[model samples]
Target: MNPTQKMSLQAIDLVGPSQPLVSLIINNYNYAAFLAEAIDSCLNQTYPRIEVIVVDDGSQDGSPQIIESYGAKIIPVLKANGGQASAMNSGFSVSAGEIVIFLDADDYLIPNAVETIVARWQPETAQLHYRLTVVNTEGEAVGFCPSPGVQLATGTVWPILLKRGRYHSNVTSGNAFSRSALDKVLPIPETDFRIAADGYLVGAVPFWGSVAAIEEPLGCYRQHSSNAWSNSQSTEDPQKLVKRLRWALKHDLHRYYWIQHQAKALGHPTQENLGLRDYMHLIDRLASLRLDPEQHPFASDASAGIARKGIGAVWQQDCLSTGRKLALLGWFAIAGFMPSLFATPTIEWFLLPTSRPQFIQKTIRGIKSLRVA
Candidate 1:
């Protein structure tokens, strides 16, 4: 037997037979170079009851051949070039396990990852969010993404999820979902979100049931040039940066709009989640500000309304600290009054207080380097 297979067998021998079955669905496109490592990671997990499935989204690379090499070890589903959402839906349609993890082709699990996840899962838990170590393309560990900072005091977390945006404290590869939760959320709405399908699921699942969390790093998230988020960070050109910012702003606005729609459909109180209401109002105000007050008659009054009620509402909430509420108000005021300010790196510094100073400094250095060249 090959070394990987033998190691997997050894690990399986250590796991108890009574463990619940977990499905690891690896979604891939052209990431052939990293595919095997991801699959091997799943195969080598200490948890014995796992079914590995690879869904190939019409990759032109040798990913199909690499998947074929696994043979009977993993189930392979090949389909036409659909986006990540489509691949996810295709994978979920065939999964039979009680727990499911949508593993990215570029990310892989730690040795005892699955075991840790299963151990922490409760019958009432709809999803479990675990920590993940961040790595570069070379597979060297960089840092870790932590679990949600706000403690979930109750069984239902829809209120907290709406208060904090969907992307906050969430890593797609670091989550495991109960089959029942997946049943409620899926088949994923591919048309609404062709990419970032996890964002949709993360936003929706909390409403269905409870969520648990594990702070220990259980997987590795590789950031590279090909990753969508990484691509925006790797550039320093002013025009490109501005374009990326606009795209991100619009994307976030779209996500918030979708969330608002979904929450209404699910009969959740969108008003009680002051953060959501504030964000929606802020986005609307910004959109209005982009046009002339004469052209958009409501622009001036709406912006003023948000600055009062929307910002005031969030500031009154107990969930956010004084500093966070101040920051939120500042962000909305600046973005509403001077939307062009975001075109510069200043917006990054304003919104992300932790890392944006370094980002802004790096961006300035890159601009200087271009001038020198």
Candidate 2:
């Protein structure tokens, strides 16, 4: 390991393994088929001190029965369908763990996941992120999502999260947050972010304190047709796909703005706050490119101006590769000049085909297998 990485590990080791109570909050909303496995995973955890809380957001499916079957093993919180954020808020209200991990209903943890997290826990660390393996509906391991850069870094990751525009590095199921951190950022602000509730939490947590990361894949992220985000990929018609993308872009823009407002309210404005401004501006320029390209002759110029600013920020992120940065730059250029191109069905199909390319899929499987080995 490099000297920096060694030192970070040493620091974590110095904290020693103090296995405090951990709360695994499983949020469910009609994911009956996968609910049992998720609870079972928690029940089977290697960690000794854990309280499993299953929050059922008025699931019409048989999920309630399954959660009830867990009986005394897990605390069941049944509430009206107030979305993921509300369910998490409810769960957090009843939880009594020093560390909290929000595990999605469709995803489950590895037996040793909580154990690994506790091993690295320190008094000052606000958040900890680890890798997660992606699985299909049949529970087959597909691939892994690796945090783009500085996976072992144990400090502020706000800048890295902002420059990338999303928390692609850490999945909700694979993250653990200190109770102190949650006290600062949660009850989740009661926003319109249903699917990307984790995004809001992920964005705000780092400001409270340092974020440590583990390179190990400690949980499984199930990608299926029912997933709010993944369901858009199944759209076959080009116009429909474009509409979905537009809606998604708008949704993300709103979420970012909300986080920015939260940061300012909390009086912890960082470079990410400015980054969110540039991102929102970029989205507005792209919208202009799509809506009134003829009226705004300088739309492309405005888009390029914002794109360059974003590129500069992205270029400094160690989590992204050179090619990824260039790809983002190219995407910005396209969004500026030919916004409709992304909306086109042909391009959408090629980029997010129902079946991903075999070579790429094979490469991911190979990488995950190596990690497992």
Predictions: Cα RMSD each: 8.4, 8.1
Clash numbers, per candidate? 0, 2
Candidate models: Cα lDDT each: 0.71, 0.72
User: What are the runs in model 2 whose C-alpha is more than 4 Å off?
Assistant: 1-18, 146-154, 159-168, 269-310, 333-351, 355-373
What is candidate 2's lDDT per residue for 1-373, written digit by digit as tens?
A: 8999999998887665555999999999999999999999998999888999999999999998998888899999999998889999999999999999999999999999999999898888889989898899999987676534324445876654445454444767978999998998888855666666886787778767788888878999998988866566565554454455556555566657765665677675445434333433454445444544464334344655665665565555555555455554555555554546553322443335564457644643444333211
Location of the lowest summed lDDT over 10 successive residues in candidate 1: 364-373
> Per-residue error at 338 for model 1, in Å?
8.1
- The C-alpha stretches of model 1 lying farther than 4 A from their native spots are 1-17, 146-155, 162-167, 249-266, 269-345, 348-373
The residue pairs found clashing in candidate 1 are none
Put down candidate 1 lDDT per residue, 140-202, tens digits, no spaces. 987666412322233566775566554334567988889998897787777766777787777
Global lDDT of model 1? 0.71
